[model samples]
Target chain A: MDTNDYIVQVQDLYYRYDKENVLENINLSIKKGSFLAIVGPNGSGKSTLLKLMLGLIKPQQGLIRLFGQDINKFKEQHKIGFVSQKANSFNTGFPATVFEVVASGLTKKLGLFNFLRKTDHVKIKQAIESVGMGKFLDRNIGELSGGQQQRVFIARALVSEPELLILDEPTVGVDVQNVNSFYGMLETLNKEKGITLLLVTHDIGTISEKVTNVACLNKNMHFHGSAEEFEQLKINDVSEIYGHDVHVLTHDHHHHGGGHLHD
Target chain B: MISGLLQYEFLQNAFLTGMIIGVIAPLLGVFIVVRRLSLIADALSHVTLAGIAASLLLEKKFMIFSGLNPLYMGMAFSVGGSLFIEKLRTVYKHYQELAIPIILSGGIGLGVIFISLADGFNTDLFSYLFGSVSAVSRADLWTILIISILVIALVVLLYKELFLLSFDEEYARATGIAAKTLHFIFIIMVALVIAASMRIVGILLVSSLMTLPVAASIRFAKGFKQTIFFSILFGEVSVLGGLFLSYYLDLAPGGTIVMIAVLILVLAIWLKKRAATRSI
Candidate 1:
């Protein structure tokens, strides 16, 4: 397989939190430059899979490869940018500016003992501008709206110019009306920058039109196919995985990520 | 006060030492306050008391250890306390904040024992507990100057790493930043600042210098850099003002400095509330 074909490939991955298996024999691949959304119910192991892929938690049995290198040995962590669910949970009283927060993304690239140079400042400026937060560079992060703060976080992850971007419920604190525009910016980043975007979200209805592929995960990989094929999934099939009725594309108006819109 | 610098060596010593510490205490305090580890400074200062009391006792018991400054031993104990706090944090992984009280009580317990063994608070110990402006020696000033240079250098070199670690530990670790090592160095810096500050601020009041200005700065400052700047500014005002007042009034330097910092905090909160209401 080509190096650019699969940015992340997990084979026979198994992880156990306490006793029972949280993720069992899960095999998934994120194609390079493709926008993939991993959709699942609350306890469907979507986060565990993301963690396994991110090398945060070690798997008991299996292999995870990133950019053709094993995740444990992968030294180019700068190539994989992550925007976590806790992005909104940051201290509202933190006294960092947008520029300072975004400048932190270059920590991996800048290495230790190296201060942020003028060139790094340009990159930081470009990232804040990319997220359309140029005007708020000097403003405290706590001063921005929830949506604006999320944009600064996205800009923080994007400052290093990673090849793959992963986000865990990037729309949690974001407003209902602006979710689409938020994702529209992400799609632009994918198409314009050739960045592979992998998002773990419950906004199946809002994100279906923008994503190139969908991976429905529940303990194991239930479905990994094109977005068009995923939309064609039977309601009962997803209901079985969630252990309840799951109505997909039912015009779910709920703005939050923890929404369980089912019959 | 200005004329005191020209006339007396002890006045010059305390004045110069206070100026340098004013910059570093709150500079490092910004990280400590934001990380919610302000209590660690308190805990470390108490441990520094143990070292001071032990050294003072040793100076009385042993002729060879005489003439040595207790602040040196205090700095060592503070650094040791920092490492122990880090270890306890790792051990109790779930209840990380428990590390503070665990180390804090242990420091006090040890401190009390040493104080008792030394036959309670002597004049020297009393001065250490509540800073003495007239007692600051030339050697103490030089020692503080060197420690301040080291603390400032380490903070400048690792500012970005420390900031990221303070803001988000998980992200810093995910990006392959040595969170443990960086945190280790950070606490050591905190320890040094606490130990260095104890001479002028006293062990009991040292944490105020490390936290009060930071608390005030966070109320109205817009960014981390601005917060740091304001923290240092507040620290300087408190130190200088307190030093001047102590010289004329025969008051304890530590008590005076901390009182001024508390005043700034109150003023900052009042001004911020006023600003918020005006905007609304």
Candidate 2:
């Protein structure tokens, strides 16, 4: 890969909790400005890998680097944004307006005890508009639909003007129609704004069409390549990556074991 | 009713101090409630009882009761207990809730021993138990004021960080917010509020001030900022109203204040349900 191609590099990463290995010997490199989707079965370490990449969790046995340096050394925290799978993971009844939640993206860069400035306000407005939520800026977050709430979170992620936006299963609980629009908007963001996108989802029907790259994962990674390569892979290969083809066939219709049904 | 406040300095002090704690505690409570750490505050207040009991016992044993006040010692013990909880929480990272019962039991056990040793059962320890407005001094007022200012300033400076963490700790940590440090600072602040509140609300009822207003606020507030504001507003109303009623009824101020807060909480929940029904 060329110098400008790669934005994230992980090598031989390992993570465990309470003597249970969550991630096992994972190695992956992601291209800058590329849209990547990570698909996996439940408890497949997809979220854990993203957490490690974002430096939320430490690798027990291997090195992970971002932007050509160790993630631990990266001081510019404001340059990246993340949206967890649970959009409602935050307080569903928290007292903030959509605008305030979105503007919180700039919290790290603002001076201590400083209220938002005019430029900050302008950027927030821009972010709201970017997510087509300008009309609801002052509305309470709890009043929003799941799709709209997810959009607000996306706006929160975008308000920082991040170079990389990592969303973990953002459309999991959204309606099928909303999922289509959400993916469309994300594709626009990746192509129009040149924003590097890393999304984790179990839904392959839509993601396989839109994302440029795909990574299949279980406790260990199985595939990391272009989406075209993923489509060409045999059913046996897909089954090996996901551990079972029935799971993928039934995922859209049935509820997985103890997995939260997101709203 | 207003004349009562002016006629009794002790009453005035109680009302003022109670009002301050009323606002600050519930303000802090919003975060705690959102973060599901409401019970932690309850545990810490109980722990503070041990500190107060120990201070009383120490004062009696050392015979240093002349010019020195025991409240300072109470505050120090409270802070120490707060730090102890923080340390324990860190040590038991996955089982954080377990720290609450351990510290609470330890504090209460020590409190039982100290209170027994000091023979403070029939004495003015009732003021520390159910809460009496008559015990607050000018010094206590000053201490409450300083702590209130510190709480307000810290909330303002770290508003976004706290908001982010309260909303989603994993996301906040993922984005490089020092969530651990913030959590420690928050618990310490809460401990200070509980300590400061002990003189007015008493150890038994202090956690009620922290919880009831938050319960009321969550009924109406839609998001994070409104919850904070509404919680403070609700707390102020409950405390001031309770103070006035306490004076009229000649009851324990802490008990009355917490009772009033509970009433308001019930009223708010009722009104919310009514509104929901109407809308439906």
Candidate 3:
């Protein structure tokens, strides 16, 4: 909430896959308890940036600081939660229950060999309740719908009681109706629970409405500022980031209403 | 059945070994089937065949060969093959399944060469190829018992890490669970099972024993651990039934075991369909 509360800080970060450079000279800082959205077209370094922050991939150059220490040196992995794109990104037939999936969030805190404790159960219950998946705890994870699966993943991420939550395309395969509720639930977590949110998505139309800050990237950053600044962005700037003339009809009541399909 | 099991030492050894494989195969197999690495087990079994053939070819006629105990050498070869497959899969990335054919064909080809060089396929080799309870030595029993403990201990100690890596490797890595190390360990474990099982199930049917129980259990089991439990139950039935039928029917134990497992799989599928219809 305070400007001094910096949770993630990236300075002059550079990354390359083979010869092609991505995320060059990337500089950004995320404040604690704020929802930040990383938006750009395909091939942009948005996903790469998030991966660097989560230490999934190492940057070619520059420093990433999380909670004031070098990202590489930070060992409290449990304090951060990650949810990838909505394609499951896992073996679909894996026979784990929603409860088991959620319980895995404690892997870092509980370590590899120890069994889940009583307090772990309490946190798991709290997480499932938060995601409105309390009733489906015993159901197999693969049996759920896309939106329900996303909620279970969210619960899994939340069970660790993370200070920072990073999500990549969380609503990609989710139904249009469910996306609204999903974002609303995320908004509540940001507002009430004070969890810092970093989301990577291409859908600016939906997420721009709720995000506190927005960064538009295209191999390298094109724009970085608050959501209000992003809303007031020039059409040329948006077109440049997308590498084409882009038009998205702004819908004001879309977030408030039950559902709106934007195809 | 109790009297039948006690009447013969070979029967006793076969039955106990069957029970052990029954538990270990499906316990590991559930993860393998879900991970879609079942074919990898098949590839590794062929590699073990090559190893066994090589061991036989190298032994002199006057030297006196130990029948089933040579399987330890086969296990070492299979574990090496597993590591090689892991490396090939990593290097290829997109066409990772390419590793399967490469290993499978190479293994089978080398096995044929080794078998030819061994001069002749004797009654011992025939039993090994098709499965034989008559070849169960005390040393073989000790090896099975020791490998079973190692497999069980490995699974217990690394249960969460293994499960996490199998389902979502990226998430496992993100969570700092050492996914790559765990994956290598799992492949090695699968290799060990394949090597140890080659004598009982033979190269032709070892993968089936590892996979059929998993397929049957997944139809009705509600969760991951439950599926594993049901797979062990199904595997136990298949192994014991197949062993008894092999003895009574005078058929190859490996072929009979696989046939029984396949039958159970079909029954499980039919029952699942009936359950769905009734629910509707």
Candidate 4:
């Protein structure tokens, strides 16, 4: 494959915290415009892997590349947008409007001492509208529902116009009703906007259909293949990754006429 | 009072320094409150007191140190305390808040020892502790003015990065905002502001000046900018009003200023309650 085709390439990545080894010898590559879901059980080091890829933490050994450049040398951070776990990332009582939150996405790209231009305002509005939050632009972020806040965060990430969007448990606190629509928006961003998506989530049931590829991770990468291949994976294989006896069940929802995986 | 401002240099010095601190204290206070580091201000203020006490002790012991302004010493200790607090927080990550009380206690303990060594509180120490309208010298005003300018410039230069870090530190770091560097810069700025503010608000009540207006502004401000605007507005009102009241009533300016800030905070809470009932 051409180096330009892959947005993220990790070779033999390893991470340890104190004495426990979180991840070991992980090799993965994410192609542009593809939606990849990294799913695993608790303590699976999904977040750790995401942080390593984002350069929040360095790997003890191995090489990771973003846009064909070494991770350490990757300077175009604005090309990749990131949203951490929803519940822990922000203060609920923080006094910030949706528009302000979205506009902050451009802060790093614009650099210090430079004020936002009129074009930046247009871009901010466009990002908020893209997340279906145009009406709430002037509203305080704290007043919004959990799902709406997540959307605003997505708008914040999108405001930078990143080619690759990575989210960690984006729907952690979202209501069940809103989780489906949230995934729907992610799918739209993946397909329509042509942005590459890398999400770490435990919502394997709802997002399986929306994602193009799945990586079952537990300390090491257990499986990495197409979504169809993931769907046909044996229960024992998934159980082995989970380190427990687990059952995989697929149910077809009559209302949406879509298949969902359940554990 | 208006005529008195022109007649006396001390009044001019006090008023000018108070006005400059009015803008900076709550401006940085907005970040401190949002980041839930309000207690750090109190800890640093106590540490500054230790420095002031030490300076007074040295002045008493030696003629060469007699003319030196204690504000410089106070600022040094405040900055040192801020760095130490950061170190302790990193050491005890699980119980990070333990750093504040430890530093606060250590500061007070050292201050007590220094005060005792100087043969107890004198007229100069009293002014540093409670603030005197006539006590701010021309040199103190200039020092405060310079510090204020530097603090404001740093804030303006790093506003966006500071906002990101205060709002979501992990995300800020992930976006390559250099959290550690910005944090050190921020704490140092906080130290400088606390020291500059001590002349008007006094070491004992400086943290109140920094935080009280923010407490009131969070009641109704719609956005971060609005919160900052309202915090500065309240800060100015408190300082200006407190100065005038102290002048007429012959009261300690620190106590007067903090009382005014408390009154504003109470009024804000009441107003917010009333608005909620009306909306319902």
On TM-score, the candidate that comes out on top is: 4
Ranking by lDDT: 4, 1, 3, 2
Off by over 4 Å in 3: A1-4, A234-237, A240-244, A250-263, B61-68
List the RMSD of every prediction in angstroms.
2.1, 3.6, 2.6, 1.9
| Minimal lDDT window, size 10, model 4 chain B | B121-130
Query: What docking tier does model 2 reach?
Result: medium
- The regions of model 4 sitting more than 4 angstroms off are A234-237, A240-243, A249-263
Expressed as tens digits, the lDDT of each residue in A1-263 for candidate 4 is 89999999999988989977999889999999999999987688999999899998888899999999999999999999998887877899999889888888988999878888999999999999999998998898999998999999989899889999999989878876677788999999999999999999866777778899999888988889899998786666677766665555555464332333334
Q: Which pairs of residues collide in candidate 4?
A: none
**Lowest summed-lDDT stretch of 10 residues in model 2 chain A?**
A254-263
Q: Which residue pairs show collisions in model 2?
A: A94-B223, A94-B224, A95-B223, A95-B224, A95-B225, A96-B223, A96-B224, A96-B225
Q: How accurate locally is residue A222 in candidate 3, as Cα lDDT from 0 to 100?
A: 75
How much of the true A–B contact set does each candidate keep?
0.79, 0.74, 0.74, 0.87
Quality of model 2 by C-alpha lDDT: 0.82
Could you report the DockQ of all the candidates, in the order they appear? 0.77, 0.60, 0.75, 0.84
TM-score per prediction, in order, is 0.96, 0.91, 0.94, 0.96
**What is candidate 3's lDDT per residue for A97-127, written digit by digit as tens?**
9988888878777886788889889999999
* Cand. 1 Cα-lDDT: 0.88
Q: Better model by DockQ, 1 or 2?
A: 1
What are the per-residue Cα lDDT tens digits for candidate 1 across A104-128?
Answer: 9998899878988899989999999
What lDDT is obtained when candidate 3 is compared to the true structure? 0.84
lDDT of 4 by residue, B112-184 (tens): 9999998896788888878878889999999998998999999988888888899888878888888999999
Once model 4 is optimally superposed onto the true structure by TM-score, how far is the C-alpha of residue A263 displaced, in angstroms? Answer: 8.4
Q: Measured with DockQ on alpha carbons, how good is candidate 2?
A: 0.60
Ranking of all predicted structures according to TM-score, beginning with the best and ending with the worst: 4, 1, 3, 2
Interface RMSD, in order shown: 1.1, 2.0, 1.1, 0.9
